[model samples]
Target: MPLWNVYHPVGAYTAQQKQEFAADVTAFYAHRGLPKFYVVTIFHEIPESSFLIGGTPSGTAVRIMIDHIAHHAPDPAARQQIDDSLTRLLAPHTRDRGLYCEFHIDETPRDLWMINGLRPPASGSEAEHLWVRENQPVPY
Candidate 1:
């Protein structure tokens, strides 16, 4: 079972938005036999104070978290495409709410996940763990 705890800052989240987002994730995970347990949290903080990069205050645009049993996915491009798709699906609902919120994704590995009494896909590659926080700086 891959569990993800998602945090949307105070101004960025609404109860309805959170529920819709969770539904999207659940459907995605259902396709692969991996259960994506969605947990949404709301917090209030300045970006500079809430996020840090290398112990320095980070000017992050968003924050998210994921926890699971641990697994892997190898295909980077495909994984990215999937993520992009998700962002697109969830973005409009948020952006329209007068929020400059960015979409953040987090995931955990699944080794022996028991979903509906079925084991999940063992693992894949590094790509499985790859997710882009859109507000991040370029990795030049």
Candidate 2:
């Protein structure tokens, strides 16, 4: 599974923008072989009074932290592609609004995680494909 934690200042994003962001982020991973259902995106709205940048309140900054199993993007190129895709895909949501944004991805070993009470199959394993097929909850 892939988990995205997106943080932005209050009033910076519309409801539609949040939905599109989630969908787009999910698609980015699905195309890389992860089951769409297992991708998760979270949007956190920070109150203007409480948000700060460079020791001052800022109205236009965003930070996204994504975590997933190592198997999802085993190659550096694949990881780089996701980062680039996120930068391009999120530009309209941030830059267009005069905001700055940053995106980061962290990979965890599959053995260190579990799903449905079971550890996911190793990357590229036949079982991994079967598990995804049986558990996928959305059509790509």
Candidate 3:
């Protein structure tokens, strides 16, 4: 029942919106029996130069984002949900265009840990024996 991580690059996310975003992740994970533990979602606003489609800077980045997410989500149900959430979050923050975004959702049990830290459950030192959850699947 831990929180998942999402690495995002998008448009419209602001400093003030951080809380809402966090809540979004919390709710996202909790929906599936997760406690919405501790998510580390980073939003990277793609600058014009950083974004391109068909050799053109996307004038409507939101659509592009939706499409992109669609391509990544292997699950149809999850695809729609993810697209909807991302689109909703970007709509208010979009400028001339909207958002061309990508989010690496690390909520699967197979994605739980690849720890480099010496912490108890993720250590490589004498405490390595204590490192647990490593054999576990990535928590989604």
Candidate 4:
């Protein structure tokens, strides 16, 4: 599974935008072969004064931290692709506002990550499908 945490300065995005943002992130993974249910997105709005860039308080900052199993992106090229995609998806919210947007990915070895008291299966594998079907008892 992949989890995305979007941390943005308060007032930078409207409620609708936040919803759209999450949807876009989810879609990104789905397009990359991940099942929709396996993607989780969380939004955190922080006070503008609480964030800094170059040691100066920032009013327009959006940071997305994504965690996933190792080899998900696989290589630098793939990682850049993801970064570029995120930059494009976030441009509307950051570019015009002179905001800073960053997408950081953290990959952990699958053997070391566990969910529902069990280790997850390989990405997009049949076992993963079974895992999703078994553990995802409720629809998102």
Q: Write the per-residue lDDT of candidate 2 for residues 1-111, one digit (tens) a residue.
A: 788888899877799989988988888767766667678889999876777877888777898888877356658897787678778888887887788888787887778
TM-score of each: 0.48, 0.83, 0.43, 0.80
Worst 10-residue lDDT window for candidate 4 reads: 131-140
If ranked by lDDT, best first, what sequence of candidates would result?
Answer: 2, 4, 1, 3
Candidate 3, 29-68: lDDT as tens digits: 4453322322344444556565676788753453221112
State which candidate has the highest TM-score.
Answer: 2
* lDDT, residue 137, model 4: 24
Local accuracy by lDDT, each model: 0.48, 0.77, 0.42, 0.74
Candidate 1 lands at a TM-score of 0.48
* Clash numbers, per candidate: 8, 0, 16, 0
Q: On a 0 to 100 scale, what is the lDDT of residue 77 in model 3?
A: 98
Candidate 4 shows a clash count of 0
Model 2 segments beyond 4 Å from truth? Answer: 70-78, 136-140
Q: State how far residue 137 of model 1 sits from its true place (Å).
A: 40
Model 4 local distance difference test score: 0.74
lDDT of 4 by residue, 1-140 (tens): 68888888887778897778778877877676665767788888888778877888887888888898623777889889877887887787667678788877888777887655655666667776664555452322
